[model samples]
Target: MALAADFRHRYVTPEASLYAGEPTRCEELAELLRHILQMVDRNTPFRHGAYREIYEALHGFLHAGIGGSAKDGLVWGVKDFWAVWESICLVHVVNQNPGDILTCDMEHLPVLLSAPERRRAWLKQRALLFARNGIRRRPDLVLAGGDDIKVVDFKYYAYMRQQRRTAEADEIDKIEKDYLSMEAYGLLLQNHFLRNADARANRLSLEFWLPGAKAARQPSRQQPPWDPPLSVVHLPAEDLLRGYVALYPHLRLMR
Candidate 1:
């Protein structure tokens, strides 16, 4: 059978008319997707999340039936930007190390496992699970081996706010909370292993990573005896996307 002229005109050749309101790219892409849908209808299979996501966006915007576009009530700018930030950081870490990073109790966070060859392993031996939203339920990531473990929390703190000379009234509170939270994370991680008799390390190695410029000298670190030695690296945004490369050697990658 042949494709309809009206269908082709509206989606494939939609321009220099009232239909020009819709982007040419969306029109072209949606037309191509028509062919893909035809294949799917014939029992051909193509399992991909990207295709589905784009299809839904196009369908709603294009009204899913004939050729008319709707842009009202369609918005960007997510309120859960923190969730997106968390996922991106996880992607960077997994992509950087490939097969080195270990995740525990991440059934709730599939973004980390979205890639087929992410090279990350699900930690089953003494894995830790918590009660809360997906982001809060577990540490962002952990690197562990024979007797060394590093629990990394991708705390998207507003570092620039605190780095300024004139701190905001809440800056001190944020700093103190961030510091103490890392301490608590250390203890939680330490006990998490000890309880299951699966102590991967003699003690927990706590580290929280922040997004910022690489420091000329060490930014800061605490080494109190009672608490696990807490260290942090302010990874540059540029380096984070590059998967921790161009980052400081201290950004330990355990494989």
Candidate 2:
């Protein structure tokens, strides 16, 4: 079966042109995405019907007009795509190290609150606590080996190039706010794992994956004061594996 079927309507053509000069690299990316889909289909608990739902949604998103009535599907599809893509990348990276154990879609990590009442309240709030505006904040992938644990969060923007060149003030503001939200999510993960006795002494790292324009990382004055001190790492889609290895040297892939 094909890894990713071509959409009947192309929402973004420049995505092809973006790789105009690098056929090999483009092919590699396509294969990786396909492998990811196949692995998820074969190994994950999601059934064939679930895979169809994803494909149908992606198809609809691609065919819909920009800013059209199908905006919700487009948004959902983009988010789902990145979530799967990040999982695949992390799995590939960790598998390179035969000794490391990689876990995808990990859940039930304790929320950072200490008091039982506060934890209960946060749990009751649920979606409100985990979401900023309409965007949900959650860790996408985790890797553990020996005494170290790494939690990764991925944020994918398909039109980041266009956003960089032409996004208005309000749009820019929204992006900054999203970064702050991501920072909060990272801190939450770090604190949550640290509070666990088993993981307390383990090395923990939280990272944000933003595969966009170089300028996307420029410090913004509107950033939240409480944002974590860690900086967002700009990782081009093509170099995801390399960038990840650099950030977590302990999880290096064996050549």
Candidate 3:
């Protein structure tokens, strides 16, 4: 069976957009479903929790059409879209280097606070940090190769529709929160991974894949205290592969 057909057979229900009469919406949903399945198939050692979360979230959105409470549904649908998008990008990079190891939701990292007591306090406060942020902050993908490690976090936001001021504000808030979380992750990587003499030094990269943005923004670099540089790449979702290459040019040599 074709990929789309196979996905529909496995996951799509009569309530899903695939069965909705709208041609354009149906086609778009079908393509997304297919892309997600392809990502799952290609990316071994995938996080079952993330996959399941996205799958269920999409299902809920499809079941609740525009006629219903679609506002919440759209929020969840886009959330899952980003999850699937990140999976697809990570899978492509992993395929390029067969020998490299990729891990998802990597939470444990060395804490290099000056005092041993401080290190323990920081470790114990991880839960508090997450609670304060209102989101679980962790690297979406971790690539380890030849003593070098690359930490990547993915952010997706649709371009702001001028009419929806509230939604735009929410997205802006999310973007800021993600940036702060990424900064923390960068610090963890530097103190935990790069502190070792044998480890290869590399910076953490945040790929903000905004498909709806009006224009592409230039990549910016930031250096946080006790952390290596953090590079932020703003690109459209269509250019994820290009963004990946821009962030990690070394991956091209592996191909």
Residue 176 C-alpha lDDT in model 2: 62
Cα miss at 18, model 2 (Å)?
Answer: 7.9
Off by over 4 Å in 3: 1-61, 64-79, 106-137, 145-148, 158-172, 199-217, 221-227, 234-255
Residues 40-97, model 1: lDDT tens digits: 5457367489777656554443334322242221122222334434555665654566
Q: Pick the candidate with the highest lDDT.
A: 1
Clashes of 3: 0
Per-residue C-alpha lDDT of model 3 across residues 153-223, encoded as one tens digit per residue: 65554442212124346455555566666667656555554456434445444344444333355344332
Backbone clashes in model 1, listed as residue pairs: none
Query: How well does each candidate superpose onto the true structure, as a TM-score?
Result: 0.46, 0.36, 0.40
RMSD in angstroms, candidate 3?
14.3
Q: Residues 60-125, candidate 2: write the lDDT tens digits.
A: 443322323431111222223554345435544444652343333322221121234633443443
Ranking of candidates on lDDT, top first? 1, 3, 2
Q: What are the RMSD figures for all models against the true structure?
A: 13.3, 13.7, 14.3
Please give the lDDT score for candidate 1: 0.50
The clash numbers for all candidates, in the given order, read 0, 0, 0
